[model samples]
Target: MARAYGFVEYGGPETQQLFDTPVPSPGPGQLLVAVRAAGVNPADWKVRSGRRTGSVTVHFPAVLGREVAGVVEAAGPDTGFRPGDAVFGATAEGYGGYAEYTLVDARAAALVPESAPFEVAATLPVAAGTAFDIVEHLEIVDADTVLVLGAGGGVGSATTQLAHAAGAAVLGVTSAGKRELVESCGGMWIESGDGFDARVAATAERCGAVTAVVDLVGGDVLERAVALTRAPERVVSVADPARAEELGGSGITRRRTREVFEHVAALVERGVLTPRVERTFPLTEAGAALELVESGHAGGKIVVTVP
Candidate 1:
């Protein structure tokens, strides 16, 4: 039996419970990981709260984590991975990441850098992957002034790094507390408040023209990005699609995002990119971690560590 973080109801972190389950065997094309860490994203809360829908909508009680890093404990038939290889990747269907063991596609998982910690490598799947997708997929390059709304968060932080790597002039919007955080990723920051528009306009004015907008903040923030964009197609968001559509934007498709992940993984291997992890919780404390992530004030990322 394996212990995991599960929830019987859709609520905040308090609803999550530690439970037992049979350690699942990897099926064909799958690798079973002895999970060291799991990256906690806002999507975990949204899907659990029923705001986001996907192929693995919970029918029974479910786990709610996504990205995971650990060692390959077992490989299913024809899997290329061998036992004891350190790996990391995005987990699909149910939140198996909040456990000591979970199954992921062998092809999708990347071998971790020998020098990186399991905790840091664990942060890459969604944040780094999505950042790579947005910058590369959009072809943001030299002299491009890319506005990163909500740049203090994981995806936003990672996006800033990727955009800077391509010589884009990145501008980040964040609360005052996060100014240093965004700047470390090579972006200038705007504190979100009453004067947000003025701050944005000033930032744009200095950059000459806004070529792209990667909004981590949806709702009114997307509208702000829309107003700032001189090229609509270059504007992108990883937020609510319904909200995105209301502003004449669309969601990032899965296939294209894969290319971004592959490109970023190379940067990670070269030691040029680092995923900033804000906090780590035990698998049993997933509930508390979710609360922090949902509070919209996490310094960077929250990860769940399993023994």
Candidate 2:
């Protein structure tokens, strides 16, 4: 039996437990992989908490991870990957990658470059993929100024770097503690708080009117960010779709494919973007790693390694 960390019920951290799971078989267009690393994100806990009702089907004894970097163990019919190929991708079934073995859709999987390590590859699927989607949707241009809310976290950090690489000036909103981290990614840090809009406006006037706002922080913060843009439609959120719609913006519409994964990987290869992996935990300590993300104190990506 393959060991895995997961939850038997929808609840808080107390619900998480380690258990033995059968090594999953690959479905058509999928690859069964021996997982080396998995990335942890807020969505893992949000779904685990039962707060994101109906967004996904939760099978009890659910393995809880989305992204993985691993060696292929088997390839399903029509998949191009071979056994022993080094690859990374989003889990074909969202709840599987927390296990020692999981399946990744061929369409979402990519060959890992020789220069990229498993931990770095693990960070791309959700955070960098989502960042790419958000930036692509905005179609940010040279001379544009884009403001990223919650810029210290994984997605925000990737967004900052990718936008900066596209020749746009990046203004990042994050806590004071993360100012250096955000700035290091070529983003101008704006401390998040009350009157952040005025600060954004002042910054924009000095550069140019904010052309786009990428909201990784939702609710009221997102609502306020919409005003910083010249048009609400230029504001998009990954956090709050409902609030975004009310403000005339919308949430990111993701295109999950191997092509997208390869593009983000290429950015990493080119040194145009970097995945800031702050900490890694063994599979046994998956709960603690997730707790740090849930606490909202994590400075960057948190990864779980499989033995």
Candidate achieving the largest TM-score:
2
lDDT of 2: 0.90
lDDT of 1 by residue, 1-307 (tens): 8888867787655567888877888888788999999998888888777665555557446777778899999999986789998988876555468888888777667887666788888888888888877776788889799888899999999989889888989888989898998999899888886678678888788775788888788887688678877787677778855676666666666542334455566798786677888899988778888889989999788899887
lDDT of 2 by residue, 1-307 (tens): 8999999898888999999988888889999999999999999999899986677667789999889999999999998999999999988855567889998999999988667899889999899999999889999888789999999999999999999999999999999999989999999999899988889888888888888889988988988888777778888888888898889988888888989988988888888888999999999999999999999989879999998
Give residue 150's lDDT in candidate 1 (0 to 100).
90
The per-model lDDT (C-alpha) reads: 0.80, 0.90
Specify the poorest-scoring 10-residue window by lDDT in model 1: 254-263
Best by lDDT: 2
TM-score of each: 0.94, 0.97
lDDT, candidate 2, residue 82?
A: 97
Q: Which residues of candidate 2, in runs, are more than 4 Å off? A: none
